[model samples]
Target chain A: MTATTLETDLAGLVAQASEGAVTPAQALAEPHSLGLLGLTSLGFLRLIHAVERRYGVALDLDDDVSYLDTIGSLAAHLRERGV
Target chain B: MPTVAVRGAPGAAAPLTWGQYAIWAAIGRTAPNDHYFNLTRVLTPPDRCRPLDPDTALDRIGTALSRHPALRTRIVPAGTAPGRAPAGTDRSAVPPGSAVQQEIVAEADVAVRTVAAADEATAGSAATDLVEELAATAFDYGTEAPVRVGLVLVDGAVARVVLALCHLATDGHGADILLRDLRLALLGRTGPPPGDPGTVVAEETSAAGRDRSDGVVDTWRDAYRALPPSMFPTPRAEPQPVRWWVGRLTSPALGLAAAALAARHRTSVSSVLLAATAAMVSADGAGDRAAVLTIVGNRFDPSRRDLVATLSQEGLFTLDTSAADFADLLRPAWRESLRAYRSGYYDQLALDAALAQVSAERGEQVHPMCCFNDMRLVDLPPGPAPTAEQVRAARAATVFTWAAPQPLVGCRFCAHVTAAGPALTYQVTGDTRYLPPQRLRAFALGLEELVVAAVAGPAPLAALPARLGGAAA
Candidate 1:
């Protein structure tokens, strides 16, 4: 997927993961820990569900959590995985 | 123990939010458990550069009381208790709500106990005892302050500081904030502490404009009436003392196993854990379908993420382990968990009405007695991370320990799971009468075994070794 499309989809998932505690623009802000923003494991799991459904790719459950710590990194991880 | 001094005047009274109202109701409905009142303890060891002195500690507490409105808040009798709802009433049920109202005292006073311990050991023991006493004793919120301060001194040096609060005043998040602010206050920081997030949330939630449907009162009502209660063994007529038994699996291997299961099942570790818990519960004869109440942090909204308030609420889930395969349960378990988290923020009065409806229909009072809390995000202090081999050996050793005694009010079961690096600690508390020490140990070990087995492979629930479920025993 193109970087632009990936960012949009990943941002949406982060927003959903936060349960609207943070907007997509706010979550995409660099260097903020999603944990502090209220992205709980449940949230991350839900984000996984959304990513799989939208991109039709599976996430390794053991994927390094640092990649999921921010919207930017998660988007990059997905791109690397050819999502 | 003699009270050294009582420090402020009665402040203005405010209405209790639905969240506070629910806690007040639970306190009134259930048998008294002092553990519920113990909010947080801020301990300062001697190693800290600036240890707290008795005078400075009291000063900091005084500052917190004056700065935060909730810290000074207490529950006073409002009008005559709302009349009790008639049987068979659902949403139509009315309240014999407690005759209590939240009033923020303009001035909050704390009851202080100054202990002059003979030595460091004495100081440590005294501090521990004082905290237990403070947490267990029921506070007369209408007359007494919701917060209590205990200062322990060794050789005239501040050895430890304990601050215990009532649930009515602050939730876990708020307690942590109070602790941080107290530390700042010790450093001589001052001002009206951060704005009262509790007030903001209450105002917004209680607003007439907010949507009530999101609370999903009906979903909870249906679950309460339909799901089977978690039947441990026997229903004791009298409340029994409570005890805590903890088991830890501090292995990176367990994490790896959980991740593999989650990946294979296309779910999260939490879902895997929940499904494993259900299998353990069913094998222990708590029935094949265990209805559990999950504690939702309720910090999903960014606005309230840093707000110091009692936003945590209980979401009810009925996990059916009737499926022989543990893997089969993850999908359904995940769905139920999500639904529970979404509906965790229902109106207290509506929940009460639902409880009344279920009670009348069942010809007995029914309550969700089992609680499962995932405290991974609660930000507990981290401990040393064990090596993979150490984690494996620790799991194999399987040692168990009882936490210090706390007052047990009734027959309530709760499991709080905390993770530090690769180590997982499952602290399980239950009324000893219902779940004797042996039974509780078995239950805890059974849970750990399920995780170990799941990590080994995609084992179905019933296909796992009987020893894991304690069934072989």
Candidate 2:
């Protein structure tokens, strides 16, 4: 899968993980959402798991999921880590 | 009384392992004014299943509880001389746990009191017969610190399970784990099979095996000590009312929405849920000044995996929503959540004390003047999932009963998120006169909506769009 599709699909999954209907584009555009930078610990795990599945790679122990503290960070990390 | 046992049949000073201790310490930090996390539930024919023989089931439960050290442990500060009575105390509490010997259960770690025929409809007009039977059944259950296993038989079947643990012993997750284990024991299932996550790891055995990790209890103290002791959930109410409610989102859509929100916010379903709940609670004029209580399980510590361990700390985050726009409120809410994350270390004692004092003068529940607990956050893997109907019925019948009235301040809501689905249950008990049953349910529902709307949009737009449930409305 192209890096763009991976980000798109993975970002889509994170959006689904939340409750309201949120477009990934608006989420990307919003700063208020920055606070949501931290999901519940378990949700955090699932997000990581989703990224792993989308790209067909276990999160590199080196990738540091916690470092994806923000949506921007998560997308960038996924881009670099998406095999 | 030789501490060691002669042979088998339950005995050991199995201390709380790193994971168990971490969790209990966490529980001790986030508990309410009273040492009661009284999470009682009415077991249906399904829940009541145990060895056909009642005696066998009791023994089995006893034996099962006996195996876990955390269940037997209690929390006493780390250096306090055992039984030497710390200041203003006469109890020689053996730390946060106590051992269980199979001697008719002098005290139950958790009592399983039975009240046969509590299934309401089937249990018609049998109050006289049932009450008489319950009185007889009650005798079989112990009433000491660690409650003995007490299961009631209604019309010949196991009915209500009363698990009253010293709040210091278990948290919501621990209670769930204990119940599932009890289910296994009743079935032909042998002791936790290898890899049964519920199987108590050696490290988690408490000092007597309850959750006697008093030292671990101080994690939140340090976490909160770092913060300014600010009053929270402003306009704190006293005689804090408490109530319990059970509600399930009832749609695969909720799960999907969660995934979508998570992807958009770059957070988890829980954050979405919490942010939503927080918004709902704050929606009324109440959101303008109140700070809801949240207990974040800080199993973040690497050495622990008792994710089931109920250890959690209290976070008294101040959410100032007096901003001009939706984003204004959302950004600060986000910042507050992040601050809470940074100071996730919770102190149950502090939380309880804060609630106690908060309730002492105001008219609101202190611990969570209104809780927005997300149980799905725990992540129970999907097994043969129960039908939504079964899960819903079980939750509906049991949620209201979990409320331990009076002496508690706020009404608390916990959302247990399972892969099968998310179940939201609230436990409230305070003043029945002030907040009646109808009002309690209404408050819970309102609170649920507020949290979601808040997280879905920004300032001046706290409400979700019409397409998304009209959050603004």
Candidate 3:
């Protein structure tokens, strides 16, 4: 997938995970951080599940979680993992 | 104790669900004191509702049992049929073996003990004693239903209802749901039908279930590898005669400060409290990174929201407490807490296998053992941040007391947070060898002081040991 398409797909998952609390546009905009963008603890778990389901790659937060700082960083990490 | 016969819609026999298996394993580990897992609740009808007579109370209890199949469910050895426990064989003596199955009975008798009191105060006292008696009694999983009911009659009217529920039947959240349904039943109303336990069993054993369980085990393996073998590896003091001690701290200031911090950090109150606990554990010289097994209520799924079953499980939460300011830990704590909660739902057997594998690899057991449970059903929302003076004044009402020591406990450090009226109560039950009675008091009080101090400004992590009076150091 192209960069834009990948981000758009991720944004859709983020929106769904947030239970519509954070819009797809807001997610794509790359706000301060997911936590600041109003993604709840349960929403974050749902996002992890959604990402794992979509990418077939489990997200390990115990590892270096700097990727979780923002959407752009998360997208970059996924790309490095051959997403 | 008078027996009340209750008949409900019977459910088919099925293998225990993943959640049930987890609690069942704990029950076995706990053994004779398996009653430790009993959840007790004393409920009274609201003033708006009419007083209940003995017959009406019995009818309500029956309605509740019929609505929630879990209340009438009984567990037996894997292959044994519901009512056909091999004739004359002692069902209670049956070992859990590798698996146990649960069967819902159409007719089961519940022990209903009644206490008559002259007034509400007398009734309350009688209810408390009855609740303690019922709660301390272990449930015979094979032969008895999962619930014991007690009614306290004030002037011949049922004024209070006490229920001692087996943890195998329901968790804290599930218990709340049961209480709500029971209240509705008392008012001659019916709530939505609860989720079927058999469906839970089927879903848990399906292909999707296996995959989910596998994923959770994989997560556990990775976490076990990353975390220290044990949070309390070295004993700081000799074990007391009792071996385990419990300390409880009730602080209105801690509640106020925690709410303020949670609001400021834009996270849940649980995360704020967890961050402080990680800080304290780290200060106690455990390590720069603190790992705690946080109890997770696995009720995120909409379908399982109202399911009166044991779905709560522990999730591993590892946090780096090497930050300069305590506030810096809240965001990461929240994030890792979410991860832990996600990892809580899995096959307990598979999780054990994974732990064994990791322990073998590491040449030691890989269990954090330290636990944190926030038992509040709904967190107190962040109100206006309390001023430092306000928090300090509220601190005068803080109470720290040592509870009865236990001969056996499940963990070295088991911390729980619950709302107590206008205060937040923190209870820590620790192995006496690791946390002496004095240190236990310090730990509980330290939690309150740390949170209350943070309300004024950013609390320095380096100053934590001194603030805790070097109890952690």
Task: State which candidate has the highest DockQ.
Answer: 3
Q: Where does the lowest 10-residue lDDT sum fall in candidate 3 chain B? A: B85-94
**TM-score per candidate, in order?**
0.74, 0.52, 0.86
> Over 4 Å off in model 3, which ranges?
A1-83, B81-83, B87-92, B96-98, B380-382, B387-389, B466-473
- Candidate achieving the largest lDDT: 3
* Model 2: per-residue Cα lDDT over A1-83, one tens digit each: 56566556756766644322345664465454332433345444445545655566554432223434555666666566534
On residues B184-263, what C-alpha lDDT tens digit does candidate 1 reach at each position?
Answer: 66667753335554455455466541455334677777777776543455543344443433334344445544554555
CA shift at B360, candidate 1, in angstroms? 2.8
In model 3, what lDDT does residue B138 have?
Answer: 78
RMSD of every prediction:
8.1, 11.1, 4.4
**Candidate 2 ranges with C-alpha deviation above 4 Å:** A1-40, A43-83, B1-35, B41-51, B74-114, B118-145, B154-162, B191-264, B276-292, B300-303, B306-310, B316-342, B346-372, B377-405, B410-473
The all-Cα superposition gives candidate 2 an RMSD in Å to the true structure of: 11.1
Q: Which clashing pairs does model 3 show?
A: none
Docking class for model 2 is incorrect
Q: Model 1: share of native contacts present? A: 0.04
Query: What DockQ does every candidate get?
Result: 0.11, 0.10, 0.21
User: Model 3 shows how many backbone clashes?
Assistant: 0
Cα-based lDDT at residue B242, candidate 2: 40
